[model samples]
Target: MLDFAIFAVTFVIILVGAVLYLYPSSRSASGIPGLNPTEEKDGNLQDIVNRGSLHEFLASLHGQFGPVASFWFGGRPVVSLGSVDQLRQHINPNRTTDSFETMLKSLLGYQSGTGGGATEAVMRKKLYESAVNNTLEKNFPMLLKLVEELVGKWQSFPKDQHTPLCAHLLGLAMKAVTQLALGDRFRNDAEVIGFRKNHEAIWSEIGKGYLDGSMEKSSIRKEHYESALAEMETVLMSVAKDRKGQRSQTAFVDTLLQSNLTERQVMEDSMVFTLAGCVITANLCIWAVHFLSTSEEVQEKLHQELEDVLGSEPVSLDKIPQLRYFQQVLNETVRTAKLTPIAARLQENEGKVDQHIIPKETLVIYALGVVLQDADTWSRPYKFDPDRFTEDSARKSFSLLGFSGNQACPELRFAYTVATVVLSTVVRQLKLHQVKGQVVEARSELVSTPKDDTWITVSRRS
Candidate 1:
């Protein structure tokens, strides 16, 4: 077990180094007090395990080491920046890459030819970016279709009690993102079902540093992962083959089919986008509902805005911009939930943050968990007050990092739209109430989520 554990962490470091394109491979971490440019990293699995949950562990580290601290994760140079100011100085550099992509490089590289060099990966990333930009407007209708389906499902449930939203939201997000990303290639429900099964297996392994083959030690999970991955590739290749020379406006795959990336590369990108889109967007919706349930003042404000902007009407894209309060609700949810608890970058050359020297080749993490709730920056930092974002204070920025100005996370922007729509639709129709005695603590996933995450009750407003 010890031998295998060491091997996994070592492999993960190389894997992260290879696929994380934005990170400078050379040594460069600066601007942190007492950080050694040449400090040796300890490679002990027990050390990592002893630390317990990564999110809680990082929070504890911030308490002990101040906002910025250096530590070793199995020989990997890690620097954690717990404050917003630290982020602005170092990670807020325009070129920072989304840390979510690090997990993608390894997980999506499941069998696709990736992590070799940045060339193909870069090109493929561009193509995927193009697909998203090209297809989001075209796909918004598809998104609404899925949203309506979800609403219908919820509407059918008994009105007296709460529904388990986590599982259902996962399905709703999976189906919507799949249809948009894969186009008609995954039209069959079975195909979507199969993809979801594989996705669950793969997603659960993320953020745990992809712990060796033990994650797939279960034969069933291993089987589903491999089979679904192969199916997705076959689907993308077939679509790319047929549509490369054709013109289609509705599907993301159609946009990709026109790209220079090979079918496998396209498939790899599509898979990542699909899986990530599902998890992040679903949780965003969940957290929004969770927050709303806990804050009746915010809920009333949001519902009033939704009713004022879109009363007795179905939610539409044109009206979304007018749903300002709903947007604040979602933003506040992300901020309070710390949906993305951390983001990181690698220093190619020694860098500095706030006059402190950061050593070279260190993983500089933007500890969003700490800053999003900074008492100095936010009035009542722990509260779920969306009104803090009213126009009088709207100009204030950098506090809500959910999907703010950082375009590093493509899916997050997409999720913002999806979540806004969900809030618009749900708040207008039902009043959310917290589940009595339901435990709703934050558990750090790749995206932060409520622990033992269940659902809130809702009743049709009179």
Candidate 2:
């Protein structure tokens, strides 16, 4: 009996070893002619398991491997590009899908490829129409009202405890975005906040799971995603049902309903629309305020622009375009901080890159954060100089990772408008300052955000 047990144990161990040995590893295909399984970079797997905070690990590899480097994360192959020229190759409009959506589907357990294609198309059309006609024309007044509410709320909070700017910014973004996306039905409602909480919780957890490689195997992530989706569907459907008899407004949900989308598509697409705007806009606001507080020069320049454009009156959408420096500051913020650092895509059919051929259906990631900060493109790449975007030196075809022409996320244009309005309104009224001895750091997820507890002080500018 002992001999038989030993034999079985040895057999299992050998079987596992054989499988690991046969698994294809990631390799640099830059100078090579064809795809071949290459040896894994030492410590690469360990860094991935550490949840993507291993900046030193990735930086070292890129330094050694040149502009294009390949590495493995579990059973997946990741290609990192560190130059604008190479990055542009992957951003060709011919590519139908983006890396962000691919990572999202994988994390959320949705089907990839054509799964979200119809919904994506409808959402894109509605977003374009809304941006061109609805947002600036129809929704600006409501947005201003929402901004006023946020300011009032800030005033209500005790001065000493006013440091929770991150939380307040998130709430403000949610209120404004939801009002525009789903109408005023769920805006500030308890149910809406609850749904946002569930969705955020699941989305955030899945990011952690992906970095740790547990999402692929974790039952907890599966349950969280399922629950969040159900809750989102319920809330959106309820809002839609309530608006059934009413004439459609210019809001996103109204536009979607008027389109040929089915009820499920309406619910899912509406949730994605709202959630995407809230997290990103909120983070941008938080970071902008933090940066302004740290740099008096930037703040002064921005205030000058705002005052010159619309002095002593509330900011409006019509006036946003005239604030050139303010716009430059926002563009620089996105370029320097990299809100959405990584963009990804998958090969539909076999495709060639340089000399090597990528197999059909292989996942490809473009680490936009790395590429955006590439030394070759931007002089003093790590510096936060808004002047880089000024008319004298700004690249005519400047592309940041947030939205590229081919790989652009449709929601980005709206996000830019919302962020511009919110920032302009707040900066015009308040003088923001960072608290002494406090540190603000970025935490990357599906979208990067200031560390959850980031705090700042606000006083009315005299």
Global fold similarity of model 2 (TM-score): 0.82
Residue-level lDDT of model 2, residues 1-462, one tens digit each, is 000001111112222232222345335443332223333422245654344553434455566776566665434454555556665565453244233433444444443333457467445544444533464467888888877778666655555554677887788778777777777675657856786687686667654555544554668776776777777778889887776557756577776666666676666666656666677678777777677777778877877888888888878777877887877777777767767665555456666655455665554555556665777777888888888886543443254343523334545556667777777777777666778888767765556677656777777767
Angstrom error of the Cα, residue 328, model 1: value is 1.0
Per-candidate TM equals 0.82, 0.82
The numbered model that scores best in lDDT is: 1
Residue pairs in clash, model 2: 99-344
lDDT against the true structure, per candidate, is: 0.65, 0.60
lDDT of each residue in 409-459, candidate 1, tens digit only: 667767878888777777766777887888878767467766675777777
lDDT at 195 for candidate 1? 77
Candidate 1 error regions (>4 Å): 1-11, 14-47, 92-99, 110-130, 209-228, 391-402, 406-408
lDDT of 2 at 134: 69
Candidate 1 TM-score, C-alpha based = 0.82
